[model samples]
Structures are given as structure tokens and as C-alpha cells.
Target: MDAKTLERLLNQIAAEHLHIDTLATRNSDRLDFHEVSVWGLKEALQAAFTAGQQSKQTTQPN
Candidate 1:
């Protein structure tokens, strides 16, 4: 797929993940609280994704 396609798909997925994470944290129970932090995971994943996008954006056209 093209960069534009991938970016659009990733943006949608990332937005969904963020929304879910916000909801999860807003009403977290003791059981879910001890589990992995959704924000941390979301942040890490977003950081990596952003880096990849930046790299792609900065690449010289062949």
C-alpha cells in the first residue's frame, strides 16, 4: 500500500486505541488497574509510529 493509505489507516487505528484507553482508565477497577497501563502502551506505540512516519516523510524521493 502507499504511504498515504498506510498513514490514513494508522491514524484511524491510533485514534481508536486512544479513545479506548481513555475510557478504560476513566473507569478502571482494581482487577484491570494492576494490568498493563493502556496509556503507557498507547504512548509507546504512538511514539514508534510517529518516528516511522517522520522517517518516511523525510525520505528523499527515489
Candidate 2:
């Protein structure tokens, strides 16, 4: 992937992670990022990474 696209993906991942962090912070019992499961934060990130990979693969060569 190009530098710009890679940077955007990284930023998106960071924002999603921060969203999970915000959710945990809103509650009394804090949940760890590792403690998540299917359909959770990690799953969301995994899907994003997969889609990003697919997009990169399918993108036209410069």
C-alpha cells in the first residue's frame, strides 16, 4: 500500500481502538481489549484489516 493509504488505515484503526477504550471508560468495571471476543472490538479490527488487505490487493497499480 502507498504511504498515504497506509496512514489512513492506521488512523482508522487507532480511532476504532479509542472508541473501545471510551466504551470501557464509560463503565465502572473496566474491560481489557484482550478480553473481547467474536463481534467485539478485536473482531471489528480484524475485519477492517482484512478489508484493507483485500482493497490493497485489488487496487490498480500506479
Candidate 3:
């Protein structure tokens, strides 16, 4: 993806992360069953962003 598109995706992910964090905080005590799922989703999003950045770096000319 181009820089603009990648940036947009990252922004969207960040927004979603914030939303999820808020939800998790609000339901922290009751979300034990879903804690793992939520954590995994956050990690996956972060990994995706990191991979995108790494790929962009590798493909760009220094």
C-alpha cells in the first residue's frame, strides 16, 4: 500500500484500539472470558502495523 493508505489504516486501527481499551477498562472485572480475545486482537493490530512499517522501509530507497 501507498504511504497515504497505510497512514489511514494505522489511524483507523489506533481509533479502534482506543475504543477497545475504553471498553475493556469499563468492563475489566466482568470481561475475564473475553480478556484473551481482546488482548490478542490488540497484539494482532500492533503486529500488522509493525509489519507494514517494516515492509515499507524495506521497499523504499534509502
lDDT of 2 at 52: 79
Q: What is the overall TM-score of model 2 with all chains considered together?
A: 0.41
Q: Model 2: clashing residue pairs?
A: none
Q: Model 1, which residues run further than 4 Å from truth?
A: 1-35
lDDT of 2 by residue, 21-60 (tens): 3322443444544454455567567867796778878886
For each candidate, the alpha-carbon lDDT, in order, equals 0.58, 0.60, 0.60
- Against the hidden true structure, what lDDT does model 3 obtain? 0.60
| Per-residue alpha-carbon lDDT of candidate 1 for residues 1-62, written as tens digits (9 for 90 to 100) | 47786666655554455433332244547523534467756774886588677778878585
Which residue runs of candidate 3 sit more than 4 Å off their true CA positions? 1-36
Candidate maximizing lDDT: 2
What TM-score, computed on C-alpha atoms, does each candidate reach? 0.39, 0.41, 0.42
lDDT string, candidate 3, 1-62, tens digits: 78876666655654455333322245445542333466657765786778788888998999
Name the lDDT value of residue 36 in candidate 1: 43
The top-ranked prediction according to TM-score is 3
Between the candidate structures 1 and 2, which one is better when assessed by TM-score?
A: 2
Best-to-worst order by lDDT is 2, 3, 1
The ten-residue window of minimal lDDT in model 3 covers 18-27
